[model samples]
Target: MKRINTLGAGCLARALAFSLAAGGLALPLSAQAADLPAAVAQDLYENGGVEHWLPKAEKGDIFAQYVLGHMYCNGKKVEKNYELGMRWYRKAADAGFAPSQLAVGTMYFQGQGVERDRDEALDWFTRAAEEGYARAQSNLAALYLGEKGVEPDYEKALHWYGKAAAQGHTVARYNLGMMYAHGLGLDEPDYVAAYGLLSPLVENGHRAADELMQSFLGEMDEEELVAARELSEELQAQDRMLVALDQRAANR
Candidate 1:
């Protein structure tokens, strides 16, 4: 698939490029603390209390290590130290923490504390994606589509995008919808599938998806429009069920 940069450019290329830029691959300090205890996590954000997490981080608490890494990276309570942040991230990642793995991958991709290494970033992203981290799956899809280092692989991109989209990742769903709408890397366009994917995105106030949906409807026939609406309803119901299942799993 060809890549284009402009927002109003060719359908598929523009959508894919927009996704690459808009979907930030990095995990911010707050996102890094998502797996931590709710009370402690909130306190860290509200008070910037790195001291509370430092001892636990030193004691090899995986979540604490990730939090310290985030704090150091953002200079929350400690001086900004990318190297120290990477060190803590690595400790947690080495223990198979998916979020820390994603953080390390982001650092490599952005050259935050180390040299930019797209290959290494891809490796770490693959690790986290395999562990069922939706963000990593989305990032991996972007990298595959963008051809950061390796040759562009639309098939691999679609696979990762589908995995992330199935987990209700908005960006991935938007990208997948665009791909289907324009027949990007496909033998034929699948407007019904595209409409189904984009419907929820438009409802969620995604301007790009809304614009695309308007364009799509202008081109679709009455019969196709009716089918698309039915398909969209089905997809939304399935998505809700998956979300409920995930919540139940998290509670357990």
Candidate 2:
């Protein structure tokens, strides 16, 4: 399977797949944070996985609770237990940990440890996304793109995707580019917009973006191409700025 960014599992727990695939334990990283974040991050790496985190989580450390949730959900160190995972996630999420809010939202969306409720998922996701969590923003954008039993709201989708893409979320950038290509939620397709977004990915050898970009060559005129090229430069600059901002905040 292609490892595109966003939450690998239907826009859920952002780093759960990475930890599972790596055969190790780690904390989920957030896009924006002050002392690193208004989200769960950092500390879990130093003390260790389940053993150490369990105590901290119990003592009301939001970061530890969030990491503990991942371990339980993925069966990293402890046996897989969805109920336990949800409990941990809820604890941190209750404390306004954005990553755990995402995890709780994922569970609600997927019915992993709780009854599936799309509205509940939306509520949780909205909370985290509003907190400027990039993964949650991407996930919320996807939902606004219309999941089962939900209405598609292109404007809302674009808003969330724009936030995430600016923060360097690859999947959000690709999806936004694709929306431009297909005119999803728009009056007409914006070839220049699509080209601006996809062109760099193509340069970087992103196969999906390359294939989509190839389709554009036949559709766009010379002027559109020039405009697209300029827009691409601008978008790339914005991406660099946002990424640097995220890094500076993370290192703070």
- Highest-scoring model, lDDT: 1
The sequence of per-residue lDDT tens digits that candidate 2 reaches over residues 15-109 is 11111111112333322222244323454344566778888888998877777788888776788898998999999899898878877888887
Q: Model 1, 105-159: lDDT tens per residue?
A: 8888779889988888778889988988877788788777764556677778877
Off by over 4 Å in 2: 1-46, 239-252
What's the residue-level lDDT of 67 in candidate 2? 74
Residues forming the 10-long window of minimal summed lDDT in candidate 1: 17-26
* Residue 112, candidate 2: C-alpha displacement in angstroms: 1.7
Question: What is the Å distance of residue 112 in model 1 from its true position?
Answer: 2.3
Using TM-score, give the best candidate's number. 1
